[model samples]
Target: MVSLPEELQAREAAARQRMEELQAEAAELAVRLERARADLSRWEITRETVVQVLAELSAAEAVPEVVARDASDPKDAPAPHGIGVMAVPPWREGLVAGVLPDVYRDIVEIVADAPGPLQAKQIVPRIRLEATTAKIEGTRGKLKRLVERGWLDEDTPGRFTLARHYGDTGRVNSR
Candidate 1:
């Protein structure tokens, strides 16, 4: 029994109230999103700090063994304690070949044998692949994945070295 004008006025008021509620909800969501982003940033920094600390601790612990090994003549130095005649630890002899796919294994082998950090292009020839643009790019992708998997280290941008744990001394076997 309300007049048309009154009904229209009521509808307009409801629409305005709904708009205000939506605006408040949007503001709340924005605030929550910002807080979540800040929390993520804090966690990322904490993770990086922890990783750096652990790397430093590992390096510090390895110093004495490296020094001792280096001081002794190659002929006179005692063989590593638990690693018998195997050049690599029995568990790690097939580590790359066992854990990784064929292409990744090839990449690790190439990096491991290199005298210094290698770029993707330098790895391509050793892998026996044509130096095409796509192949080189794919090699780069595989190298990055190896870095993520802790099998390689990016010594600098576009240059990779085998991760320190896999060094010549077989340090990882001691662990």
Candidate 2:
């Protein structure tokens, strides 16, 4: 029993109020979504850090045993093939590629063959690994390890080359 124009105005007011409520709810949800994304980013970083630390721990624990066994019986020592337990010994004056695990040796050999320093992405294809983000990052880690162990040098950041150049006579020359 209201006038038609008055009823239309009342309905419009209600619709506008409902729209404001929905807008407020949407704003709140957007804030929550942003917070969740931040939390997910932190958790992803934490997981990656934990996995790297655990791998280092496992490598550290296994090193002494590999050393002892290799020292006791050189020939009887397990063939260094996989990356898991096959430790990369620190480079020495007389040490050769034979000392490294197969994967590491492949890296060293590839670097040695290259005309100049190479990036992890460049090395990935030579090593027969897919040129994916994960593969490149993993190779970068191995390249860093080689740098740390004195097997490779990082003269410029993110580029790797051999620490010592191998001569035609199979002798190592300081680079």
Candidate 3:
């Protein structure tokens, strides 16, 4: 379908003949694809220094009472050497169960351990914290916020009930 000038047409036919003659000299590059991939794969850094740095970084993610609202109870609180905020209460067993961070785990423990509803004032002294966790007001906010999040039931104006058992508050499963 493609047309050319008569002189160009003859030149094109000659070019095709040359291409066919040279075909045996040129090899397909399909095998180079995997070789290039293998070369790229070799650039990966598996050095111990890089791995050690990453390990230290992962260790650094510890939860504090103020920032992470982490819910780590004293019992499960890991040694403070690592990055990840202490052991955040591993997200509880069921679906409605929250993914409590290390700080919240402590709050959950404190709330659940108490005999009954506890006021923020009452809970202030009970929380076991070191210099790393800052002060009481931050912890109070964590507790109150947990109540609002349905992790605990607030009784009076400021008292809280541990909602670890009766989760999802009063919502009934109609099924």
Candidate 4:
């Protein structure tokens, strides 16, 4: 065996110390990572619990309904950030597609100029859709969306009446 010099022995000791320090640092990092993982799991459970409780409260239909805000709440309370759910309302796509072929805003204006209810059948021919136009499934679906969104309501199911905002008298008879 080759003999180690005094300097070589000192170097070996220093290398061993460095290896131990590195191993200790690596161990500490692993422990911290595990803790972070546990904390993340805990936070996920917390989110799930909050969602469940909110959904149940909304479903129960209590008087002071605790509805979940579709947007972010303040870091503190009482601040509103966003609007409506990410889930599209069931009627929205069909409504958009139905109105896509027609000049919808113009039609709203046209009907607004009229005093009485506009029947679904009555508004059909008023829509101007060329054969090449993208989507013209029927105006019925779009009309239904307007009703659902509270822009219009049906005096009868087939016949839709406009909201007070339609004509701009600026006064809704609250009765």
Better of 1 and 2 by TM-score: 2
Give the higher-TM-score candidate: 2 or 4: 2
Task: Judging by lDDT against the true structure, name the best candidate.
Answer: 2
Report the lDDT tens digits of candidate 2 across residue range 13-66. 999999999999999999999889767756765776677556655655655553
lDDT of 3 at 2: 48
Q: How many residue pairs clash in each candidate?
A: 0, 0, 23, 0
lDDT per residue for candidate 3 within 1-175, as digits (tens), equals 5466877989989999999867644444545766665555444323433664554446355323433433566645554556354223333325232345444655666776777888766665665532122234556677767776656777676778776553444321212
lDDT of 4 at 72: 54
TM-score per prediction, in order, is 0.41, 0.49, 0.36, 0.34
TM-score of 4: 0.34
lDDT at position 150, candidate 1 = 69
Flag regions of model 3 displaced more than 4 Å.
1-98, 129-134, 164-175
How far out, in Å, is residue 171 in model 4?
10
User: Lowest summed lDDT over 10 consecutive residues: which window, candidate 2?
Assistant: 166-175
List the candidate 2 regions with Cα displacement exceeding 4 Å: 1-86, 165-175
lDDT of 4: 0.52
* lDDT string, candidate 4, 1-175, tens digits: 6567977998999999999999999999999998897677567557755774565444334323234554455542322222232111232212331222124444455466567778656675665432211122335666777667655667776777655443445222222
For candidate 1, the TM-score is: 0.41
- By TM-score, rank the candidates, best first: 2, 1, 3, 4
- Show pairs that collide, candidate 2: none
